[model samples]
Target: MKKQLCILLAAFLSAALLCACSGKKPAEPVPAVSAAPDVTSAPDDSGNDPAATDKPSVPVDTSYNPETDADNLYSSANTILIETEDGFYWCSSTSDYLLFYDNWLEEMIPVCSRPECEHFPDNNVCVQNKKCDAYLEAARHPALYNGKIYYIDSNGIPNPNVDGTRLGMRLFRMNPDGTGKEFIKNLFTPGYEDPQWLIFHRGYIYGMSPQTIIEQGEVSGRTSIIAIPIEGDETTFRTIYEIDNQGWGCMRFIGDYCYFWIHYMEGYYYVNWDTGEIIDEQQMGGVALRWNTVTEEIEILYQELLPKDGYFGETAWVERDGTIYVPGGDCLMKIENGERTVVFEFKEEGKHFVAATVSNGIVFARTVPEDFDDPYGKSEFWVCRFDGTTIFKGELPMDWFYESPEFEGLRGKPRYPGFVMTVGDETGLWIEFGAHWRSTGYNEPSADFLVRYDFTEDGGIEYKLYGSYDDIFIEPVD
Candidate 1:
């Protein structure tokens, strides 16, 4: 009778899975023509097996420290990069493999442990060799906390006992050496869309999910902020806040607060999902907000109606010490303890400060023409101390691109240089450089290299290349 009951439960779950998938899109979309089998995993059953609880049984180490900067914490939604004392570990932007960059050596290598592994797919050599221990298929929002690396595998593992059924969007963790990987929990099932902008802090994972709603023959999207404990399952998932309109939401972390910005259309409304209370209703423009991780309270930092030009400007960045830097008309303003002060001002005739980022007692500011036709037009930058002392001011040099040996053969194509200033510190400013492959068409940008501008004591700047993406593009390793 027990065997019959288990079989009946399996059949019922399969039926439910089919019904769920039929009504909504899959949890993570995969290529339809792929030869690889669907990635899925067995649903964790903690009640049946003590070992299946999916929580780490070992005590967490309290000494593990991670960078709390907004740039490092929330680089991108699809990529996972984390810094440690040893080096940087990130999921490969071009493939399903994980890679490590040695800060001292300034070299990148696959995170594989095998001495002679080529880190490539070879079915004949090993079964599904591409899916190695270092492989993170559809990896998102990876974090290093308490000596373990936790991440979500949007492309999940398949259950062997249940055909045509998947566990769907699971959380996992492994050692820094890419060993002892264990499944944590099924975050979301097949019906719900995968979470975005995941953040791990204070023993909980916070994320946002986009919800599609259609009313009166019109379609729109809403965003829901959620939180779940690291040791908990889907049953513990909680919706903290919800917005009534789709918008560009960027989540950043500083100290005990999670800061985010939402640029919505046709105004917006904030709803506290837990209490079913309407929080705020804004008729125009964007809003800056911060949520306290300890108190679970949401606070609005700033909001403004749409400007006549419709440009809402960039989002404000908060420092680790709780200081906020907001971009005013032509100056960068710093707010601390409810006191506002102008840190840097663009005094040029027809230019204004477009964006600014603060890190390690340094402020990097950029200015652009107030009336520019092309969004990618010429822009200048300044590196200054927090006390308003300028260290360097100039436009980034791109002449080295045509002369560098790395772009020797690729120079024949119509390539345009693109640079993104990511972070700055006492050592220098870190910028990521890419090239637009105009020959291929628009939107085809190549990952070129990551460069740093070292600040000399004499106020001179020196360029250093940290890593290059030439191998990934010049020679296809797949």
Candidate 2:
């Protein structure tokens, strides 16, 4: 009896210990995790014609006014919205209404003038049918070009922060308003993974797919750069370049060639798009590069190294009139003949310019103060001519509630602008003010706000807030 009682006590203590050990800490911030990371999911494909399917249409609530209720626009929910290539502040319609992905209702809602309209895929009277259907589980990464719209259609999986199963991705296309829905091809190939890069360039679609190569029964990974001609058959996929052990390289077509790197902050391979010939391969030793049309060669322009604590990252590159500008150690620098000169710098020693963008013959530089209390720093937006002539400088017309929290003895990310790009004459910025650290093994929650900055002729800038969403990437249609 004494032996049995001791055994039972030991078993109970072991069970309690196991339960306590299973509790996990919050996930680390993104960019500190794996070199290659994946985003969200869509809905399952039924293969039925979206128009032929029958479903009741639900009327979207169009009562929210941004101009009046702008202060009350804070929500912790994940909603999707669409932005045009031109960034003209209106959806692709005549009613001047903005289109949004209603999260709770699982349908596309609009702010159009029509009151009796329904936005479901089966409803023929819905106005959004020409641009997007209600049946789309998740349609994202929109690339508009040549009278057609291209996007990734997914299986509407939840928890877009971490990668779920590859339920298959459909590369679909339609008209500007959403009519003439046509299936392009399935992006998912058996045994391949991490379809992260996609762009339309010069009458063709460029993309990268990471494939697991099984060699001698051992598994390895390889990233394949593929090109699909827009006019050619969708079934015909061609490989432009293939590299092994490369992770998340930025690919861009600046001028006469396509520029990309195999790994981060390494050398670049410049290739002529017309012919699959490697024009030049050179190491930049920096985060980004630019094509010098005068010298007919590429130059490593920007190289901003973050601190050792992994709090912040490098900003986007800005180019104008064949000249490139980037954020450097403490100032904005312009690259000339592989040499960088200070284009603009802050007088304060603690302040640093990190993000640079160009639009309408003007270069915009975003700065932040590094006082440790606000390591993410102040969002001071400055504008200048392409020749580095400073014009306008002021703080952005917005306030922050709370920034990302600093871990124990580790730095945290303050409010900072992630991607700054110019779409037509207007500039679009993706800003993150608050980030909730995940309790699981993943990173921070995938949420960010989009802001549009319109620079007027009088040199005054206008700001427009586009709400928040989870991992929505907006691009200008070429």
Candidate 3:
């Protein structure tokens, strides 16, 4: 009987162990670690996190594909509007807010998504209380690349001193929906200014920094091509190429080479900033340079000498296939494979080709009177194929702005149409009319209109009203 009791006790202990094992839950599978670094995880030296602290927690999309990103050809460092995948992202020209246009909804809204959050005044209940996602304190340049929006904020970080001044400019990036805002790097300190021509290409942000150097009672400016890696911290800032005694001019990129112009300031006259005295009076020439992005080598493409009173337009453009186009006095010149060719020469009397640009295999040339002086004077525009076939050659209809029903009250007023952009095959024109005069005795357009023009297949032209500038903003104007 004692042996039987021992056997039953052993059986009961085994059964109890089995029941405990089945009652417990199985462990969850461990998540796989991401290969890309968490750029927002690291804190700065000041022990403060650069990422938005009050931002609502949202899942980040890690499927960024550079190959399918939008090409940022029209947006430049100084441009207010930047094209993105969905629509355009633009900084308010009149405010400190960043706005976005939703193509599907056909509505413009601030980058902030909080329904009850006011964008202004930094109230306790507003989005600006902690930090507004759309607030750009002195927005310098905002660009879109590789599914991210990059921009420079001049007054982003506050100084530790008693005065309420800013420390320096900060580079930042955010998602398309204004979430996951992260600070990339600090560009410069108090004495230095923000760089110009902010462009995000290949995996870096390229810009031109016009730095002023003073040594031994002489003042000189150094224009440098700066490159900063998009995924790097502050230590990755570098000057790829620099030009002494020159200033920054026009810059364009073609493939891996960045084509730009640097003006000569060796003998140019300029007043001293500190003393306000005139310096050298003789003006010099300028040179166009091509910088290789990979090798960081610079090559001079063209050079032109200027007289004391000569005006250098520096109008040049590069195509995607490494073809360069420049407008001379009366002809359009094309350079490819080190071979210079005159694509077209205007033999018309009293007409001079002033500007030339290429878009979607078509060349647009502007011609003006030989004695043209007014900056807003009437000029003729010529649209031609790559083989020099004339598509259309005539002056743009300036009267369309006055005739449009949208500007009913401002009919027959002095209107000026300026080139805005070229989208697909259509060219955009921004019309500015004298609606009111400011307190500074300067006439400014209270309302501006954007119109798009395109030539049809049968040589007919069609004009469409894109939108009004005032319609995109939320604030009311007088």
Top model by TM-score, which number? Answer: 1
TM-scores for all candidates? 0.66, 0.48, 0.62
Model 2 lDDT per residue over 326-396, tens place: 44444555545545556665454655665454333445656655543442445677766656666666666
Candidate 3, position 136, lDDT: 62
Best prediction by lDDT: 1
| Candidate 2: stretches off by over 4 Å | 1-140, 154-168, 188-193, 208-224, 234-237, 242-251, 254-347, 355-378, 399-448, 455-460, 466-478
Q: Which digits, one per residue and each the tens of the lDDT, describe model 3 over residues 130-214?
A: 3555676534556555455677766545533314354655787766555668887765432242365566555656665677878
C-alpha lDDT (0 to 100) for residue 265 of candidate 2: 27
Report each candidate's C-alpha RMSD, comma-separated, in the order given: 15.4, 20.9, 19.3
Candidate number that wins on lDDT, 1 or 3? 1
List of clashing residue pairs for candidate 3: none
Per-residue alpha-carbon lDDT of candidate 1 for residues 392-420, written as tens digits (9 for 90 to 100): 77776554565555455432353444544
User: lDDT of candidate 1 vs native?
Assistant: 0.52
lDDT of each: 0.52, 0.38, 0.49
Q: Which 10 residues in a row give candidate 2 its minimum summed lDDT?
A: 17-26
Winner on TM-score between 1 and 2 is: 1
